[model samples]
Target: MTHSRRSLLAAGATGTLALTAGCLGFALGNEPLEFDSDRVAPADETVAETGYEERTVEERTMERTEEIGGVERDFEASIWLSNYSKSVDYMGQTREGSAFAAVSVPGMEVAGQSVNPLDEMSNEELLTEFLGRADSDRGDIENIQQGESFTLEILGESRDVDTFVGESELEGEPIDVEIKLTSFDHEDDLLVLFGVLSKRFAAESANVELLMESAEHPIDT
Candidate 1:
């Protein structure tokens, strides 16, 4: 894990303690439910039309054990992620830029504790956690500058998102990347959408937004 990721997680852990006290759904006898990775990804037609190829669709889980009453209890959260990429000509060379969406829901396992981690997190915190969990293979994100706030539609509902600019190494070259991140409650799930665009082409940023706007995994798929 990178230092940035560790720091974000540490901050979240402390915030969780204070937020859980007022969470109405905190460990309300709900069983943890696993979401289907296939359904969380954007539709095939959507990707094809957007000229992006699917890279990965998988469930990423985070497990933790907490000591309560001198006994150890285990808890876990399942995060469904769907990644996609597209090749573009940048400075006369073909380069691949990527984007992805990750979704997590309530009802995370709480063992004997009354605090549900997901329920305790706000949308901004959820976005931070999702960004922190980015794969190391994607290169380390650095010098993040938070940008504008805007509204976008996801799962048919309007959501507010914050934009950010960051630098990352892409194939031995430094590339400026734009990130649009948002987290919000939708129906029964906490939906987090993160779109990354390498500023190789002028249209790449718009493409990233299109990819995110088209994100969806049917419940039955």
Candidate 2:
């Protein structure tokens, strides 16, 4: 019941990433639309070609409360999602699919009082948790750099987010990642949300920048 190799890295490593399609040209608002499970019907060719199950679609909506610094932050959002699970499937021994995106209520610290989603784990922690296993083709550890936390207007509110991007080799192949973590305003937790794209999708630096700048929420306008 495994999805794919990248999917496992996506979950165990950096939390779930998100793919975006404008939710079907729907206005980016708090509106629950009908999502047919059949839309994600597995392609017969995909199953036949890869010995994998066809992906199915599911309507997903959720809400959760995260505690940060003894305070509560509430979050909610909905999307059509697919699931993947794998174990020792690669070559009957190697691995893979999914981690859900995270959402944080937007807020910032004031008067030097700390208030952001659970402090984002340090880059070192992230490396251990996510990229520690990468095998650089270069035969040396890839250079990783954590950017400073910054704020931008997301969903009509000012928000703070931490970003990280690193390079490495996995099984002798190159691996590069860019992650953006954030905390909600009214809570003390941090989350991974908004969107994710492969190098093919994010070919331009600007596309990656856009994903880091945008976000999703259950907020009704």
Candidate 3:
């Protein structure tokens, strides 16, 4: 964990003494909380005010097709966009029930214009550049170790994906991390996707492969 995150955890831990950690998770990315006050509200009231509900939902298989860059494309998956963690670090989960977390801290990097200078590189070069940058960019993650590098497809675009192993301290408890990252390349532009999940969930799901294959053929598969 980074020093900044530790500080947030410390503050949140202290703040959670009066309230619950769920409240802190609710405040995750919404607003800067003012904890100087001594007011303590009931747990149910606190939950009601935040309006962040934790839900376990089953996924539905679906497909979407579109034309981009004068080429036809298809996207099939068992999950739709679940922005349940919009105000937090995660994106959503796959139909196989794995969590998708942000690779770069929000606002630290934007998906606009594919700032990826490797857009013109060979597949080998792109994978090499991406793994190195990913190691550096994810500073908020702890003990991250790169696993493998390969090409994959998303939304009919072939791109390089790298597997990673790391650690995360959720609610002050350490959890093993496994993540896959890739970019959807289209017309010299890119769409980056990052998925982070616990070791237990990783062992139980084929979501990583399914997501990469959603568009039909994953690169180098």
Question: Relative to the unseen true structure, what is the C-alpha lDDT of residue 12 in candidate 3, on a scale of 0 to 100?
Answer: 31
Q: Write the per-residue lDDT of candidate 1 for residues 1-221, one digit (tens) a residue.
A: 10110111111333332223323232232322222222355567877877877776666666555543343434455556666777766568776666656565444323234324666765556656777564424577788888888887777978787888889987788988888777765544566677777766547666666666766644453
Off by more than 4 A, model 2 = 1-100, 104-144, 186-191, 194-205, 212-214, 219-221
Against the reference, the lDDT scores of all candidates come to 0.58, 0.34, 0.37
Which candidate's lDDT is highest? 1
Residue clash pairs of candidate 1: 39-217
On TM-score, the stronger of 2 and 3 is 3
Highest TM-score against the true fold, candidate? 1
Q: What is residue 66's positional error in candidate 3, in angstroms?
A: 34
For every candidate, C-alpha RMSD to the true structure in Å: 9.4, 16.7, 21.5
TM-score of 1: 0.68
Runs with alpha carbons beyond 4 Å of true place in candidate 1:
1-39, 66-72, 109-114, 118-124, 132-138
Q: List the residue pairs that clash in candidate 3.
A: none
lDDT of 3 at 162: 73
Task: Give the per-residue Cα lDDT of candidate 2 at 217.
Answer: 41
